[model samples]
Target: MDEQRPAHILVVDDDREIRELVGDYLERNGFRVSHAGDGRQMNAVLATRAPVDLIVLDLMLPGEDGLSIFRRLRAESRSPVPVLMLTARSDDVDRIIGLELGADDYLAKPFVPRELVARIRAVLRRVRMLPPSALAESAVRTIRFGDWRLDLLQRNLIDRGGVVTPLGGAEYGLLRLFLDHPQHIFSRDQLLAQLARREFEIEDRSIDLRVSRLRRRLGDHARDPRYIRTVRNEGYVFAQPVSYEA
Candidate 1:
């Protein structure tokens, strides 16, 4: 058996104090940490340092805000790197945008160090838990539900017309969880656990937001969802039968 390595983390923030504080904390908690002040510096670190398992990105930066940097990062990198966004704002606009843009998680400023550590671990664990078959190419190539087809190998959705819509990491995870157990009702708490989200995330409506995004991708309306239906106060259910394709 091979020895598992500690997760390497990149802290991208303009504030020196914050970068150092977070880097020190992560290092203390058995992670390898690298610091970057701006997008340029972040790119430099990414180019020079060892492969990073996750990134702690601050929304507010001196040049090229975190969102733009994230967009560029996603466009340039072949493999996706999980990002946990840090926002000082109280509003959900930036957080929602980050989520829609495929951020792995988000944290507001004035956050406890322990919570940050916990969220990082949760995100990395989700990435690490991908089955060997999923990591490579699985025997099951795609799953069909209704008019849409989910490409398991590429982690994207294809419509009847062959339009491919890419899903974020969180969206892919949630959709896979639902598809794996059709007709099974999953409460918010249950969804949180299955998605590896901390209890603290429920207050922020994380599950609801993710589900809404998925529904939009599937062209399923919340009021009259054809595939995913809400069960009043209980939770949501994937009401469609799924077929596997090789």
Candidate 2:
């Protein structure tokens, strides 16, 4: 992400070996790296000259663990840095808690360093993943689709009530696909294909769950929906006209 800026990333782990290993690997990947043995050390690193784009944090620590640090970060910091939680447990609860608490991603301990690098790159890439022509879009300004006023460049979505709702990863992707191809009936498989190109994914159920989640974000009730309509035996349809100003 920010290839020219050389992403500044801080590694926080009680394990000295882990801290250096991760820091060195990230530095070798052409990123600026900082290491901290604990949460206090992490705080010191955050006060450095160069800003940190992301953090690789271990779940267990000598005193302040990754989850604790994450809570403190949300409570205290003005700017929230994306976090990749490192854990030794394969517990689903750990993963769920980390995600629920705003972690961008997670890595189990004893993972491939190469995969680690890839995950880091992927997470950072999202922050800088705007299309090459995004600047032009921002310059021209507004995009409206049916009753939804989507600020394409700003990544802002305003509904019919003028309420600004925050959308997560998969929700935005699905919404974008539906908006881009209004009136087209796409099977779940087709939707999955489109999303797979953008992000790492799993089963068709993941797509359904994302759609359900998106509906919640859009404040759409299944009984009486305004935007997305479901076909009982067929696939999903974007049932509305999407218009763009920019």
CA lDDT of every candidate? 0.80, 0.73
List the candidate 2 regions with Cα displacement exceeding 4 Å.
Answer: 1-3, 130-246
lDDT of 1 by residue, 1-246 (tens): 011888889999999998999889989999989999999998888897478888899989997999999998889875778899999857457776776566777788989999999888766755654444434345668888899999998989999999998887788888987876566566676676656642223333778888898899889976899988999977888888776767
For candidate 2, report its TM-score.
Answer: 0.56
Task: Determine the backbone clash count of candidate 1.
Answer: 0
Candidate 2 structure quality by residue, lDDT tens digits, 88-207:
855545655765565667777888888888878766754454334432434535557666787665667897889886655667778877765565455676677666765736477777
**Model 2 worst lDDT run, 10 consecutive residues:** 129-138
Worst lDDT run of 10 residues, candidate 1, spans 195-204
Give per-model CA RMSD: 10.9, 11.5
Q: TM-score for each prediction?
A: 0.58, 0.56
